[model samples]
Target: MTIERFILFSITAISLASLFYIPKEKYRQALVSFLIFQAFTWPGTILLVQFGKIEFPVREFTQATQVGFTTNYLFYPMIFVWFVIMYPSKACLTKRFLHYFIFVSFSVWFINFTTIYTALENPLAGTLFSQTTRSYITFFAYYYISHGFIVWFSKKSNLSIGG
Candidate 1:
């Protein structure tokens, strides 16, 4: 298969495999985080594609949707699940901020690198800031907003966050 297809398939396999790593006691937390994060990613991805900010040229469900189904609906949410479950809850404000920075930074870097190497156009390239800058902003926004929602949900449900 082509490298792009191979990369996508590998990502899918890894994401699926990550699910088994979640502890049994945290299964409920994992499910809640996954579903809630998807609530943000799905529409956020669609809007990004719709407005020409991004495109997944090699993606599943192309005929049904322009969004990258595997990345938006599955991979990203799974990442968020781990993020919430492993959060450094007792960390000071600076460390907490660093956590956000680290996650967003790595995600954006990996995404930009992979998409470019895989022959997909970089999202929001040259919109205003450089492509990497714009991607950082976009990813940080998604993570921040979804994290807030997850925290709120956990509070309302009386569920504890962090391992």
Candidate 2:
């Protein structure tokens, strides 16, 4: 298979395997986080694509949607599951900020690398700095919103955050 296809398959496999790492007690949190994150990702991806801010040239569901199904619907939500499950809720503000920064940076880099390998052009910005800046903003927004929702849901459902 081609490298792009191989990379996609590797990501899917890794994400699936990661799900098994979640503790049994946290299964409910994982499920809720995954679904709630998808609620944001689905429309967010569509808008990005629809507005010409991004493109997924090599992706599943090409006939059905412009978004990358694996990334938006599966990979990202899975990552968010871990993000919520492993959040440093009681950590110092600096540590918490670091946690967010680490995840955001990794996410932006992942998308940039994948898009470069799988597409003919950069999807978001012209220069590397500009691309990284835009990606950071986009991903930080998604992370912030989804994290907030997860926190709110946990409280409403009587689930312990980061337990």
lDDT tens digits, residues 6-47, model 1?
777887999899988999998988898889888877887788
Reference-based TM-score of each model: 0.85, 0.88
lDDT of 2 by residue, 1-163 (tens): 8776787788899999998899999999899989988998889878877888777777766688777788778888888888888899999999988888988888788877876666612476366677779879977898998898878877855558887
**Candidate 1: residue pairs that collide:** none
Find the 10 residues in a row with the least total lDDT in model 1. Answer: 120-129
Candidate 1 regions with alpha-carbon error over 4 angstroms: 120-129, 156-163
* Cα error of candidate 1 at position 102, Å: 1.5
Runs in model 2 deviating more than 4 A are 120-125, 156-163
